[model samples]
Target: MDRKGILAARVSVFIVSICFIAMGIMRNEHFVVFKKAVKICLECIGLG
Candidate 1:
């Protein structure tokens, strides 16, 4: 590929990697909040 095409490809890959990493971090946070929320909801429903 030409230089510009190669550069664009590299940039796209970098962006994708960064997005994946960010989502992974957010996923962890989401699970933590999700677990707590589920517990609270269950208690409110008198199942816990």
Candidate 2:
């Protein structure tokens, strides 16, 4: 992509990430995320 398109893409990624973070914070979803991440990590290590 061109310079402007590249910048827009990067900005969009940041905006979407921020939105998800805000939603998670509002719903206290991040707490559950840790458990899910632990499961994922365990599966990755072939221990799950």
Candidate 3:
């Protein structure tokens, strides 16, 4: 593919990913992910 087509694909993918992320945030999935990550880190440190 040419440079312009590659750039357009990249932009479209970015926009789609942003929309999915926004949906996840609206559903509060980010907090759930953050909690899981924190739990894993604390367990690794023997704090949980």
Best by TM-score: 3
Tell me, by lDDT, which candidate is best. 3
- How does each model score on TM-score? 0.56, 0.63, 0.70
Runs in model 2 lying further than 4 Å from the true structure: 35-48
* Model 1 TM-score (2 dp): 0.56
What TM-score, to 2 decimals, does candidate 2 have?
0.63
Report the error of model 3 at residue 7, Å.
1.2
Task: Please give the TM-score that candidate 3 achieves against the real structure.
Answer: 0.70
* Candidate 3 lDDT: 0.93
Off by over 4 Å in 1: 29-48
Better of 2 and 3 by lDDT: 3
Per-residue lDDT tens digits of candidate 1, residues 1-48?
Answer: 999999999999999999987897777976776778876576678886
Residue pairs in steric clash, candidate 3?
none
Q: In candidate 2, residue 23 scores what lDDT?
A: 94
lDDT of 2 by residue, 1-48 (tens): 899999999999999999999999899898898777766586678887
Candidate 3 segments exceeding 4 Å error: 41-48
What RMSD value applies to candidate 1? Answer: 7.7
Report, for every candidate in turn, its global Cα lDDT versus the true structure: 0.85, 0.89, 0.93
- Residue lDDT tens for model 3, 1-48: 999999999999999999999999999999999988865587678886
